[model samples]
Target: MLGEFDVGGQQALLDAHALVIGLGGLGSPVALYLAAAGVGELTLVDHDTVDLTNLQRQIVHDHASLDRPKVESAAARINALNPDTRVTTITGRLEGSELDEAVAAADVVLDGTDNFASRYAINAAGIAAKTPLVSGAAIRLEGQVTVIDPRREDAPCYRCLYGDAGDEALNCAENGVAAPLVGIVGSVQAMEAMKIIADVGETLAGYVLYLDAKRMEWRKLKLNRDPDWPPRGGGGGPGAGLGGAGRGWIELDKYNRVKKPKHPWV
Candidate 1:
């Protein structure tokens, strides 16, 4: 049924492991989908316990999950979805050395955490560990998802976008979010994660997908590695596309169109 995925791709998912940070809005669907997709192992991390308020978009949890650690609750759902998946729960702030170790252990990392500091830390750890990070966030009526893979030469890290800009984004707790916005973002995150693990198809590798639910619009913003990134290297980095041959930052719309065909009987 999936022409893009062959036996090798399914096997790749079974042999891969993904580390998911945060088990709230974004993490909920990310974990569930990854498990259902047959990711071999998952390491779930979150320090918070499920609250009744989380039920709205944190679809992985239920009324019975209240007061339970988010990692535990999400694991329960993952297990029910696929009993073969190896689930590991870490109910603590995964930072410093612990975060580094976790990222190093997995084939890919999914970042669903909402705050800047946490995102920055996860980005640095993923870069250090040379693992891919599939990051997603939803707040208010908008959401965005991107893949930051240091392992992909010249690919940007999460810090490249926000290191200088700083994050003005507020958490869902401090703001109101449309119930399904996180679902859309999280599903995309999961899709990107599976692509990285299975090594199939083009991913959101060098682009960030932004969704504006108000107008129901989606935008793919090109990403450039920070000029000052890696700090010591000159501003120039690896060129976009394969083998540094691509012109920097191409506009996909121009190349991906087909003119209406001429009618023979016209």
Candidate 2:
């Protein structure tokens, strides 16, 4: 099997290192496909556990894994599928110095997390590390995907399309999400990650692909390179998206207080 990938010119993918955040709907498919595609090293980050409801969309976690940490469960599945692919599990949020280190080590970072804070953190880290970050988001029937290569002079980042944490919308927990919707986005994320690592295919660096499952339509949202933004920088404090504004904190806290028992996706 290893020989098959090596001889087929897929050796680059097999030797590639990727970091995947969140082990839910999007992360599940991204992780599974990347591992099966023979990525050499994969790091799965998620602090949440497998709730019974997650089984609907988080296909990586089975009924038996209910109540187990999502990252651990997802890593076990990846190991079962492809032992040649090394899996590392980080059982917490990616923040502070820890976030910087993870991004620095990854050849490509895949964003499957559902929250704005985590997404922004990964975006800044991608810029700091100058690694390509493939990001995707899905809720209800809508999905979007983008690849950000900070090293590319023409690439647009996650913040360029949407502001930082300011006025960020609710995630799947509050609004609910469809199962297959994330699958579509995750598959695209996996594709972009592969292209970024193999240095082939036209990557989605400056554009966002939006999918509407109900209508079965695909929209490509183009983003221009913002020269005004930092061409080289670290952290989301000053010139970051939304200018370091985080108005979502208050509503997020309130929502957590009410839905803490019902939903545990964080």
Candidate 3:
């Protein structure tokens, strides 16, 4: 076993609560490992259900779970893996007060949902709660992972990276993806979330870990802080995380609503 984490870290994991949004490919590995690692409680959220096509990478569900809500399928898997880990399931998207309440209750939040809409809303919720967020995405042969910690002023939030990229975030359904790609990214996400729960190691905050499966290589790219976001001071309070109007796009309209993701995300 790695010595970087000890009994105290193990205990920290046992006491930690992790909220995982999306019960699909990325969420599959994240939920399984978090439970296996002994995270005390987990809140699983997904508006979709399992389908025959999902078994490729959505390893949490099998044929028997098809037609079942993703959260329920994943919770069952998590319970089977670690009976002591308490699991809660939410059948739909978390928005407004519901979103904030969920993020506030968790020690860390994991974003495995596809689409910029869900990502942006989750980002805002994480920032508002000052919670650590571990986000992962995979499509085709590529994947990306990052940490946005509102607790750290210098760390960049989700909007900082994709604000100018517009509201478009691609998904596996629209674009073909290799089955194993999500597994790699999801595993890294699980590791990062566990590290946060255990209070060990430096997280990917301010850096995006990109993987190219075709080339089997990884690049850690630094994320620059947006000068206008979180509105410098009393304008939106310190670290409001989504306030500034620098990009010509309206933040209020964007954060206030989450469009349905192009694909069913886990």
By TM-score, the best candidate is: 3
- For 37-116, candidate 2 gives per-residue lDDT tens digits of 88999999988899998999998999999999999899889999999999989997767678889999999999887766
Could you tell me which residue pairs clash in candidate 2? none
- Which TM-score value belongs to model 3? 0.87
Residues forming the 10-long window of minimal summed lDDT in candidate 3: 232-241
Return the candidate ranking by lDDT, descending: 3, 1, 2
Q: Report the lDDT tens digits of candidate 3 across residue range 1-266.
A: 55766788888899999999998889999999899988999999999889999999999999999999999989888888999999999998788899889999999999988776678778888888899999998877878888998898787787776653343444578666788988888899999998887878899988778787889998886666677675311122222233343532243222121334544233
Provide the lowest-lDDT 10-residue window in model 1. Answer: 257-266
**C-alpha positional error of residue 162 in candidate 2 after TM-score superposition, expressed in Å:** 0.8
Any runs in candidate 1 off by more than 4 Å, and if so which?
Answer: 165-167, 231-266
Alpha carbon deviation, residue 136, candidate 3 (Å): 0.5
lDDT of 1: 0.76
Flag the better candidate by TM-score, 1 or 3: 3
Clashes of 1: 0
> Candidate 2 regions off by >4 Å?
1-8, 231-266
Q: List per-prediction Cα lDDT, in the order shown.
A: 0.76, 0.75, 0.79
- Model 2 C-alpha lDDT versus the unseen true structure: 0.75
